[model samples]
Target: MAGDAYEVLLTSTARKDLDKRLRKSPAKKDKVAKAVKRMREFGPTYPSFNTHQEKRTSRADDPTYISYVEHNTHGAWRMYWKYAQDKIVVLYIGPHP
Candidate 1:
């Protein structure tokens, strides 16, 4: 893995969200882990089925520019994030919003 490809950071809420999801379906850990790996290696252009940036109006009041990666093949699992320089901070990980 290229440590410098993208520095992956996870927010506390995102970590909790992933934990909750993992608790519900432990079998998905591999998929989630692979998704994170691909995301880090390829960033927002990870070739997922649907990847997009959230519009300001949809973000409520949060000022950080965020994007989403549709990681699930047949479900709504998504990875919400933002990129600046080489940082890729994950803001959320759960159902599509």
Candidate 2:
């Protein structure tokens, strides 16, 4: 749907985390990008992932209420994020933290 789209942004910590992680494993970049695209096109759900594939976080516990995305080859990598007014602010990257 037209209104469900969102733009994704990374926080400073998330940016640093991504850079560090990607530096070690550049191949995972495409998977990360796909997750971002899903977030943008679907606003966290339109890809209709199972709970294992995506979930929610909240500002009370974390900086997100909606979530990041995907499983990883090396480990459980993810993005914690929240959305408002067409923006998905990625609060963190890598692991469940």
Candidate 3:
């Protein structure tokens, strides 16, 4: 399941970030655990299947970006993916806030 189009890639730094936060506060740990569990149950579902355009000035001249709004049990998460060659690539995951 984790090997398909959706790959949960947590680097060492990201893992450290998660561990530090979870260790520092119990609330954060609970919230993150719940979010993770929700993710496991439901891969990712968008509130709307519609596509939206975004302007990313940080990327320089090529600032045009298209994104989708996905939701989970906790809240909504923005999914930046590219639909090419009949494959969907999930870029990242995090709370909307």
Which of the numbered candidates is closest to the native, going by highest TM-score?
1
**Candidate 3 lDDT, 47-80, residue by residue in tens:** 2423454444324433322333343446544434
User: Count of backbone clashes for each model?
Assistant: 0, 3, 0
Candidate 1 off by > 4 Å:
1-4, 56-75
Q: Which residue ranges in model 3 land beyond 4 Å of their true spot?
A: 1-7, 46-97
Show the colliding residue pairs in model 1.
none
For residues 1-97, write the lDDT of model 2, one tens digit per residue.
Answer: 3554677788888899898988897876886777767776766665433222233433453344534355433466676665555677876666555
RMSD in angstroms, all models? 3.5, 4.5, 6.5
lDDT of each: 0.68, 0.63, 0.42
Better of 1 and 2 by lDDT: 1
Per-candidate TM-score against the hidden true structure: 0.72, 0.66, 0.41
lDDT of 2 at 84: 56
Model 2 lDDT, residue 92, Cα: 64
- Considering TM-score, where higher is better, how would the candidates rank from best to worst? 1, 2, 3
Report lDDT (Cα) of residue 25, candidate 2: 75
Candidate 2 lands at a TM-score of: 0.66
